[model samples]
Target: MNALLSKIFCAQRVLKNTPPQGEIPDDETLLRRTFRVAWPSTLESFLVALVGMVDTIMVSRLGAYAIAAVGLTTQPKFICLAVFMSLNIAVSALVARRKGEGDREGANRVLAQSMVLTVMFAIVITAIAILFAEPILRLTGSNAETHESAAAYFRIISAGMIFNVMSMVINAAQRGAGNTKIAMRTNLVSNGVNIVFNYLLIEGHFGFPRLGVAGAAVATVIGTMVALAMSVLSVAHPEGFLYLQFQKKRFRLERSTLATIANIGSSSLAEQLFLRFGFLTYAMIVARLGTTAFAAHQVGMNVITISFAFGDGLSVASVALVGQSLGEKRGDLARIYLSFCQRVGLFCSLTLAVVYSVVSRDVFRLFSSEEEILVYGEMIMRMVALIVIMQVAQVISSGCLRGAGDTKYVAIVSLVSVACIRPLAGYVFTYPLGMGLFGAWIGLVLDQFMRLILTSIRVRSGKWLNIRI
Candidate 1:
């Protein structure tokens, strides 16, 4: 076992054009550096995903329509967040670079500008989402049974967008500055709040009104509000690496900073658009499979999301470590760190794959008791075990590229694989081949592998090291 694990984690052995074994940091040193940042972020994301799965379990008791209704709001919520998501990517990358360059004020400037943009965008998007909630849910393939509930959930969630986006931008900056523990703490508290409220309001426990689907949305919003407060406080300390200056002079945005944000964020926005479009279309295709199937699909997705949490946490570490290394003009170290990240990501993915395969049936049973839903969920989750291996690797690769300011390449990859190939393949398999939910998942699997292949090629070429922010 020790020998096998050694082979799995020997990063330099697998990477192309790597430095000599003695040139890079020893394995113990790399592991400590990586996990120092990774463990908190990993725990944060895992807890949040765990809470989300628990939230679904609670809602599942309300039946398949309820689960489907909640699921219907998923893509639209992310779509609403796309702008800030893109901006935050820029914030994290830029901040990490500035930190490595030892320009404290520049990092803070990036934070201020991103916060300003997040606020302006959030307000407009929130209003649009609220006004057009019905049409949007309908477009997501919401039927009469789930439409009204989904719309209510969507509207409530949309109204709270300001809090969520604000917290997100702040957390992004924190992560880039290598202050990952702050964001982790904030999210952990936030998820805790969400679960408590969900218990109180979901089924009317402790004299609370039973709000059902609407309650879940309310719980989520309330949690984000808490997170926003904690995030703001995190940077309020004067001695912190990232201090939030509220004064007029310090808070005003500069044209050069905005231009930099635009340079990186524009491509990131394109990537987000492609991802959302492809995911939305794929989801709509599956929704057409009827409520039970979609519910099972949602459950399967929730389980897969648990695996995604680990990948996302590691990806955050990669972005910060890679960006900082490049800023310090040590491209060799950047490559080394990236390779180590990939190795760690592989270990995590393989571990999750095994666990998912072993307990696929029991995991589905946690969400529902229906024989048909269980059967569908088990098959889809078995696929998830394979998909996660590819998904984690690609996600980390993309993060490494983005950290190097190679957003355009990642964006192009998303365009070709996510926007074009995924949905097209899904449609053919679902309708033409009559493969149903499982077919849609095959498209997802294909998408992950395509991304892994393309991004791996880009990483091997080593051109991203020369790209400048």
Candidate 2:
């Protein structure tokens, strides 16, 4: 059993810390506190993806064409999310710092500004997607048969961007406040509603006609609205640590605040853009290998996505913890927090890696009955698991750097690894050597390896310790 499990879940170790006299909490206390914040957010993220998985299951009944259509349409969804997540990156860091410094007013200002930007982006993105929906679908490599449904789905989902942005922005604030339960509770409510709506609308159940492609988009919209409502209510509740009150006079954007947010936000946005583009590039390559391979890739990638969602949660906690420690003028505390988070992430990622290498075939088989797809998917995913497990250090360390307001450098490093090196490696490996599918997957590993080195060096050098605001 041990050998069977070694393919994933290999990293295992407790977080360590040493409390100062009447100053820092003891190691056990610190770890527990961080875990309390991280666990729910992590679980929430995992569950968030589960809801999507369920949506996929429900939509699959429409047939394989529908499944493929949904899968293809989701690419643009990722791109849009990548764009908006940038602002959340800045919002989380800024709000965390403000809360740590006991500046609720400042945090509120940041939240308000984030909302404004999100609203503006929503208007622009939705208009663009709606006006040129067909072109966008074509750009994503969709065939004519799938184009109509994909375009329609994209159009409607674009309308929901406002609510999606609102929910994300609010959670960014709440997560940065070191209060994740609010976000988790809101997600639970929204996801529950989403499942019911998807079931009812997709199948035309309970007197509702089956809406097909449009139904999925409508379900997503309803979920976003519900999630937004929960977010607004949560923030408004007296006991909630984070809430937004419209400011009559605080509407103007401060240059310093804009500069900080833009600096961090743009950096984060750039990294995700590059990362997603890399994945999209790899997907294109896989698409050439055969439809079967591409479909298998899609199924296997979801597992990786599920795993990374937890990593995202852990990294977010690292940001909040490190930012708060810095706000308290405790650089040493921040460093300690950084180390502890790094250790925890490393352990969790490695553990999952072991699990994948061993039981990945069984896991992959759960999603597909076709032996060929399962076999290839198991092989490919095992490759991903190998790198992803050790790469948690890089993710958490990058989060630590961003938390300390070193966003620009982090962006630079990420661009080099993700943007330049990754695509270049993939191209060379694919075209010149004829390595094809395997080459593309291996290229991803190399990109992550380089990122691991860059992030580790940045964290160790302590230059991020000097950044303020």
Candidate 3:
């Protein structure tokens, strides 16, 4: 038990307290302090990834074709999420700043506007995704057999965009205000619900009719709906940090607040779109490679996504802390927060990479048993582990940039890294050199290295603070 606890907290940041009234801690303290805040977040990511893995497994059983289909579908979903999720981060940054400066009303105003924006964008994105699901699936290199399966699955899951957006927005808001436990609990219960529903609905266990791929869709939707309810209850509860008593007057968003969100968040939305776009391209390339490679990439990607949750949670916390410090006009505090997060991220990526390297086969087995797909998944997983150090640097530095209202620069960097660098590298590696799946993995690894070096330099140079967003 003690060993497990140590593994969890090893080299993690400990920004569990509200930032001090006046002074930022010293560099040594910043370097050495256990990242306590990151611990819950890392565990929270584990639970979320577990659900994702289960979702992949439930779909994988139908066959690699289904796995490929869903995997292809998820590429766009990440971008879709990036769009709406940026607004959530915008809200979090704004609210954290206000809260840091001791202005509750300011924070509440940001939350109120965030809710309105989240719903409006959700409706717009959902319509486009649902209406164009078939074409998008076609573009993903599907045959007739795969397209029909993917379309049904995507359309069903896409139906719940509003719910997913709401949960994400509110959760970001809560986390920014230093209330992460609630979001953690919300995900835990929500993932459990998703797992149970997937088991019963997919296999037709206990009187449920077999729904196959569509059943996985249904389970995800139900999970989102339940999570949405919990988030609403949290917002309604007076004690919650982000609970908003939405007044008709407050609904008229002040231009200043609206501008703050848009100025920063537009970059985030764009960054997400491009990032996902690049991922979609990667998916397309994998599809072009062949169905087996595509399926392995899908399952392997899911496992990687689970590992990614750790970096993401830490990044989110970094954003809150860094943004709050900047809001308080304490650049020193921001620096401390940024440094601590980078160190913790490095530690996490290294540890998780080691684990991925050791238990990769078992991890791959959770998704598929087909010799071809399993081999592909294991190779990608190991490759990802090798690149873990670079991944850590990129995630932390990106988060630091985002927290400083430097969303535009971050967006630009993402485009260069994922869109230009990764896909281009993948093409070069695969087509010219004939590296295949290993080549694709190499592309990703190199892209990550470029981002880590560039973003770290950007953070250390302090140019991000000059951005007006």
Candidate 4:
């Protein structure tokens, strides 16, 4: 017992000293810098998630059909915008590296090329969505009663895809430049606008047209347009850190820049596609259980996504710090930043897990008064509490790898765990074992654990440090 205690003491000491190998800043300095970048992003993501929850709560009053209608759109909408979102990841990483290298022209050029790409992709995706919204809804397993509302919402939102994509890319560029406050403010304003309009339009509170589900779609579009305008103005401002030159020469598509961004972005795109496909399948499986189950699942998802916002906020910081560190040829600093982010993510997740576990019943009650929905939703939230810490760890690690231009590995791992394992496990648990919604959540927890293990392995291997954007 004495020898064991001595070994435990030695391990504790080693763990305490084990940051990445390099001269890191003092803990206070590191924490300050991390929060300087992280808080704005965290606030923005939390506000976004809050808006989603509000949307769910508001629509829940409309009935289960309304909830399922909106929920059905989530994965499909993500699939539609996957390309633009992935491209923005590349834009963020490239802009960060250029900024670190003090190459303002290079960074601006990346922005310009990214804008051009965004416009083209947005136009194409919008056209496809507008043309195929119904068919896509049907393919995603929307039932007869829900698909009509889903299609209407999908069409209107798809029409405004350009606004959303542009807003995202511009904000991503600003984040890469370490100007997170702009994005935060934009999202905050947008959320406020969305909530106000959702109230006015959904139920026709203020003599507005009672558009129902279409009202929610319209509100989102308008909010996105407002955000797009804010982002554009910020970048166009002369005193802005990443102000665009808008010269004809600057607007020209540089093949090398395009190729480089595409190289990094393709992996991100694949990862999103894999994840979305898995979600699509999972949704389909749940849809088979009927409307109440799916609605309960959506409510559970909205609440769980709240935890993701915190992790994602830390992820934004990781991307900025790690990308900048690598650009300065300081792999050690990159690793140190990643370590700090992981610690922050783990703590935040633990807090969220405990809170959700304790108050989950109350939280689910906020979204629905239906006893059945509330019961299942609470169960799902409890399952979420069990897995959120692992989920956040994986998300932050993926961000670190992304900043280091190691997206392909992340994509591959996601494909294996989320895309492949999750749906398969979900089906087995939900149908073969007859565990219902509980089984589906078990599959989700397994996927999170798998991702946590895989991403932790990749980050610890330190191979990402050598990857060059």
Task: Please give each candidate's TM-score.
Answer: 0.97, 0.90, 0.91, 0.95
Tens-digit lDDT track for model 3 on 63-89? 878787777778767666787777876
lDDT of 2: 0.76
- Which candidate do you rate higher for TM-score, 1 or 4? 1
Give per-residue lDDT, candidate 2, residue 245: 62
Residue 430 in model 4: lDDT = 98
CA RMSD per model (angstroms): 1.8, 4.3, 4.1, 3.9
**Candidates' C-alpha lDDT:** 0.91, 0.76, 0.78, 0.87
* Candidate 1: pairs in clash: none
- On a 0 to 1 TM-score scale, where does candidate 4 land against the true structure? 0.95
Winner of 3 and 4 under lDDT? 4
Which candidate, 1 or 2, has the higher TM-score?
1
Instruction: Count the clashes in each prediction.
Output: 0, 14, 7, 0
- By lDDT: ranked, best first: 1, 4, 3, 2
Alpha-carbon lDDT of model 4: 0.87
Scored by lDDT, model 3 comes in at 0.78
Q: Per-residue lDDT of 332-435 in model 4, one digit per residue for the tens?
A: 66776777778778778999989988998898888778899888967888898988888889889988888888899989988999898889999999999999
- Which is superior by lDDT, 1 or 4? 1
Q: In candidate 1, residue 308 scores what lDDT?
A: 88
